[model samples]
Target: MALTVHSRFHPIHTDLAVVTLTGDVDISTAARLRDDLAALLGDGARHLVLDLGDVSFMDSSGLSVLAGVFPLLRESGALALAAVNPRIREVLRTTGLTRLFPIYTSVDTAITVLRAGDDAPS
Candidate 1:
């Protein structure tokens, strides 16, 4: 199935964006994902929290997109993953990405961490 992305900026933290993706993140959709996320980053979204609760599958292209954006976000803020499924988490773990981004139990928890201001990771 085609990927569906739902992105929204937090009401209180305007620069923090919560993006949720559903469906596979493969060659077909990876470019779109990258462009959409790059747009958010360019639009002043320094902090990004990805709600992976609904994401079913991902490939290297997807991982590349996630890894590629980390540097930009790191310059000012950081990225967080929320509600990651076991299979996807395993992929992240196998690739040692668990060290790169913090994973939270929910979108709210991730938002809370990001909203903590400078205390949040960059």
Candidate 2:
């Protein structure tokens, strides 16, 4: 199945883009996913939350796509994952990537927590 990627800003935090992915993310779809994700950051997303509840499978290419964005994001912002399944979680664990990202149980929770950090008095 083709990967379906969609992005929307949080209602309370316009700079945070909540990107939702459905279907498989493999070699065939990794490039397209990369472009879509880059577009989100380029369009001024200071923070990103990826909702992966509906994405059933992901391969190394997909992991590569996600890993590729980390540096650019750290220079200006952050990235989080939501609703990751066991299979993908294992992939991340095995690759030692789980330490690099904060995974939440839901998109809403991720938004709330990330937003709270920004809202803190500096």
* TM-score versus the correct structure, for each prediction: 0.94, 0.95
Residue 77 Cα positional deviation in candidate 2, in Å, after optimal superposition: 1.3
Write one digit per residue (lDDT tens) for candidate 1, span 55-111: 899999999999999888887798999999999999999999989999999999998
Q: Candidate 2, after superposition: displacement of residue 86 in Å?
A: 0.8
Task: Estimate the overall C-alpha local distance difference test score of candidate 2.
Answer: 0.91
| Candidate 2 accuracy as TM-score | 0.95
Q: Candidate 2 residues 43-85, lDDT tens each?
A: 8899999999999999999999889988878866788999999
List runs of model 2 lying over 4 Å from the truth.
none
- Span of ten consecutive residues with least summed lDDT in model 1: 113-122
